[model samples]
Target: MKIYLAPMEGLLDHLLRDMLTRTPGVDICVTEFVRVSGSLLPNRTFQRIAPELLHGSRTPSGVPVRVQLLGSDPACLAENAAKLAELAPMAIDLNFGCPAKTVNRHRGGAVLLDEPELLHEIVSSVRRAVPAAVPVTAKMRLGYNDRTRMLDCAHALTSAGAAELVVHARTKADGYKPPAYWHEIGRIREAVTVPVIANGEIWAVDDYVQCQLESGCDDVMLGRGIVADPGLAARIKGLPAPDWDAIKPLLAAFWDDVLIYILPKYQAGRLKQWLNYLKRIHPEAGIAFEHIKTVKDADVIGAWLAEGCPVPAAEPGWTKA
Candidate 1:
């Protein structure tokens, strides 16, 4: 099965991509969603989200990174998509899955799911704007308020020339709630001709099995799951889980990279947001989290995590969904 890394706005930056790619079974990485509206953003903005584009749309380890666009305007999106295509990304993914209230208020992200025809126009325009060699794909939730119009939206994107679709298996109202409803994703795959990737609440290898069985999709994309366990994708591919001895040195290396790349650039709170995920895999992460809660300095927090925080054990029968 193919394992694609989900684009988490704060957590999945270039440094994180470099860290995770060293682990096995990671096929592709989608950069954090880039908002497209009005004018195209500056080159540094695109370069920051997708530095891999500088390396010709692939990571130093040779893993491909796709740029994702989130917006409501077809004309603006198409224009910006063309500009980004010039940089030669591996692919362009449309985002109709984010449930952020600010984004929805602007008629972008999940709100677009409510307007299937408009979604078609946006996807079709973007598809036509880019070269044929550059694949255009989409990621979406079931619907805005309900799953009633989910398949219709999927069919709309597919017919509009979307090369692939990743269904998050939740409605806008659901908002990361329990029960991902992979069955609904299976229904979408049956309805559309393009490849469908099941995404939502997959935290472990067993959940991968259940999601595949339920959605009948050959690939799975992870968001929170990968954050919770860095070795998750590798484990799902039948590789041995990273033991504490191996995990320690790897996390130490990740801390060094984060301190150099992520800390100085972001505010203390944003840095803490990243540690909230990194702590999941590190030994003594709980202590590190407490340290982060009280410490405002990135260096202090990094020192705490590096000083050997005890890793929390995974709860029995735990699953992200």
Candidate 2:
């Protein structure tokens, strides 16, 4: 069974990719969607968003990272895929699963599920543009506002040459709600000959097991669940869970990476975001979050972390992404 780290816009950048992949069971990661509109994006844009491109499209942990593109235009998306192909990504993934209103309002993401023909055109055009050796895959929700056309949309993507598909198991209307309809993914998987990876609302080993039993998919992609517990995939694969002591150094290393990669103003929010997720699995993380929830200066947070902030002595020498 393959375990993939789901591409989460805004939250799952290369920094977290490196951090999360440090454990076990995470086979591949899709970079946060690189929005393509109007014309072909510069190679630097892909590089800036996914510097792993410069490292043979692999994260610091050596896990392969595939570049994902998001847009509505078939021809324009194709042209950009050709450009990104020059970088030799593991696979070129199209984004039809993002449910952000701004993305949907602009005719990107899950809204396109309403038009299976358009989805077909976009996937076919890009498949033709990219080298055949490089697989073209896609991720999508069950539908836009409903699951009425879920199977039709799955067939559309597969018939258009999408090598594999990931079904998020809910409609855009679901909006990250509970009770992801994994059975819906089973229906889509049965309809399509290609591999189907199940995603959405999987927060534990039990959830993973249930998702597999319900979706009939062995490969599963984890989203916020992995963020909440960096070692989630490892634990599901039967590795022992790291206690709070093991998590503290990652926080320090993450903060270190944030300082170098992001501006000082945005750095605190980055740490806070991970801490917020970590709080779900670590009580000390909850205390740390409370200590720095209102604090803006990253230096202050660093000082608090060095002093242990309830879970002290973050060991140094974490590999930076």
TM-scores for every predicted model: 0.88, 0.95
Q: Residue by residue across 184-278, what tens digits does model 2's lDDT show?
A: 99999999999999999999999999999999999999999999998889888898777788888778878788889998768888998999999
**What is the Cα-based TM-score of model 2?**
0.95
Clashes of 2: 1
Give residue 91's lDDT in candidate 2 (0 to 100): 93
- Candidate lDDT scores, in order, read 0.82, 0.90
Q: In model 2, which regions exceed 4 Å deviation?
A: 311-321
Candidate 2, which ten residues in sequence have the lowest lDDT sum?
Answer: 312-321
| Colliding pairs, model 2 | 308-312
